[model samples]
Target: MDPAVARNLKRRVAAALHRQISDEQRATATDPDQAGLRQRGRALIEEEVARWSEDYSLAHGVPPTREQDRALAEAVYDLLFRAGRLQPYLDDPEVENIVANGCDDVWISRADEPLRRVPPIAESDDELVELLQDLARRHGGGERLLSTAHPTLALRLEGGMRLQALMAVTPRPYVAIRRHRVASATLGDMVRLGAVDATLAAFLAACIRARKNVMVTGTQGVGKTSLLRALAAEIPPHERIGTLETEYELWLHELGRLHQVVPMEAREGNGERGPDGRAAGEISIGDLIPHALRMTLNRIIVGEVRSSEVVPMLRVMTNGEGGSMCTLHARTPHMIVDRIAELCLEYGPRMTDALAYRLTANALDFVVHLTMVDETGVGGRRHRFVSHVLEVAGLGEGGRPAMNEVFAPRDGEPRGVPRTPPSCLDDLRRAGFDPRLLDSPHGSWSAPLQLQVDGRGPGRRPDPHANGREGGAR
Candidate 1:
């Protein structure tokens, strides 16, 4: 087929589909009738395409090829059911993340591949903005807008993908679609993925069963949430679990093992100021914490602690029932005290550094630090693994957290030796876990830590600067 002819056909089909969609929207204006309206619109588009094809055949005295017809149909479908050019990437299960910079630039990261450029998702900046707006309106339950006034859009899509867009605030629209690949996972799955070894997996499961308060720490995009979700799966099937988040990231309610799951998401204000110049209708995680407590939750899971909410989260961890879990951003487990103290101090005036450190020490039991490491041989793809596991003993002499490094890999290896005895070994034993497992000087790894890309062993000492450690292993 001629390129000119194909382009013309595509334009015509897309135009017809767009017109049909508009007519359907208007016809169902107040009532919506989304399903019926979409059905009617698709039927109209097929009718129009059939008429156009017949007219072209009669005029040219030849039928279009199957390829041309298929192209025309796909063009119409793109305007109808799909999100224009982004539908293909969204359909791919392997795609882990999709990033769009304006309309012309698109990039995607796959589960098994590194970041790579992809075809444009929109023809122009305006089209890109419109697409994002449509996505927020359709999938986000019409709770958001992407305009100069709002200037931002954040929501979850129909396929459980999280979409965030920064528009008008930046030079061009920036959008990211984060796919939750580990929606339904278990501790065994983490072991299979090399995120943790079987020994650590068993230990984590025991901790969960023992109802230990756990916090997962890692740098951004290091799979902290993934590990948190896997740990959540370790909870017994009978216990009720509640999760609170800024966004609905932990899909624990969807897990099969858990029968009772209450999930709450924080909401951004409507960007409107009231008579007293106060933000209206804003709901924070702190606000939700008190409400979640009323539900008689067996455990509370805060998605990520980044603000004043740490105050309530800490109170719940210490004063409330055990088995609470949350994730926070920290480079290593040892830095958790300072990070929590900083967040509390930065977000609230009443919170003092002394109080923050005291609360963290009394409340949190364990911290698992996740990091991304390059694989040695097979392929050098960056893999996220559990690098360190530290037990929060108590406040030290200087008010810093006294951590027992239960697991620390030398040279970025996935496996590590157990440095300190678990504080909750008795609890773990009562929960039907083998207490002898904690006695092992070497961790559950059958072999030694050998995946270090630098060819370094556990005998190699870590860089002093990597973590803010003063003297040898406090």
Candidate 2:
């Protein structure tokens, strides 16, 4: 027998025995050798019984008893399936992200906090690819593995989960699975987790409701899109929301319209790229801008602005609705402004950096940023919304939006610059925003953000899904 398998059995039996027998009582038992033998033997018996149940189910059509069913599940789990290389952590809900540095090690994040190694999920490059494909197929409908010919692929899973895989021409193949689950959420959840205060969260909710063109920026695995969606979830029921992305993401209230538009980048050899000479006959996000307008959307939400789509997105949001939200990739808040400005110039090369900044500054009303601690950081760090809310006060002379260090929850309390003039707030006021909302605490403010709040879906509402609400997310 493989030593690993035998040792795993020993460890599992010992653990089960410990749970079944009290330490003090076990110490008092006579014939210690026989007692120890019996404990492990009984554990093995139970373990085998569970394993047999699973095997029986696989062989026959019958379901096992609830006890037998659970044991069978554990036995199957202990069988060392291909996904097992990562071990117990893979099954742990607290872990939010898993990263493969190479073949021998895997890392994960807990509670917007730190990355810690549990175990590797594969033995070699090939095994890792297999697990990657399996995960992709499970989360996404399916996936394609490629070499230099295909290069890279990114798709949003069926539930708006994001997955990206890249194949190399030189180095080894690399795969990353970014989990979208957040352990702590809700206004109260945020306050308890030290992410944002009720006040700041309420302010953010207000920002979303008013239809501010907001962008969330964060490093990889920092929960940028999650924060954006948390805010977007507040969009009133009456609005028609059309979301464009490479995957299906950006959910809204059940009563509102949710249209998922997947924009696939044209590939080479497939002869997809056109005159642009980039994105392989690319249907640039610029290509998708006109499509959103065609939808007559009340608001547009882009997953993340990683490319020149930044320019077209800005143009669309500025021209379309006064209230929209998007996410951007950046290490910091200021970097987000610069990235957006740089991307805009891709579409309008004649536009100066100053003009680009002004466009982003004016086009965006606020900023929210998240950061995940590097694994090397002391005491192992985690990802958190470090810069929760930033008020974009237009472009400074240097072509960066003057970031107003507004009230961010410090130790769950509002910190940073105090209230500034309400140019953005004034727009909401003009739109008939509730006047009494500003004075409420973080969790209680219920101001509505919509050009006009709708309490129903788009003519045809899908029936409420069973087991629909996961955690607290609606």
User: Each model's C-alpha lDDT?
Assistant: 0.77, 0.56
- TM-score of candidate 2 relative to the true fold: 0.64
lDDT of 2 at 265: 30
Clashes of each: 0, 17
Predictions: Cα RMSD each: 6.3, 17.0
Q: For residues 220-262, what per-residue lDDT tens digits would candidate 2 score against the true structure?
A: 7666666766666666656677666655554443314333332
Per-candidate TM-score against the hidden true structure = 0.84, 0.64
**Which numbered prediction scores highest in TM-score against the true structure?**
1
Least well predicted 10-residue stretch by lDDT in candidate 1: 465-474
Give the residue spans of candidate 2 off by over 4 A: 1-91, 112-114, 131-145, 156-161, 183-189, 253-284, 371-383, 386-388, 394-403, 408-421, 427-474
Off by over 4 Å in 1: 1-37, 51-82, 275-279, 375-379, 410-414, 448-452, 455-474
Looking at model 2, which ten-residue stretch has the lowest summed lDDT?
445-454
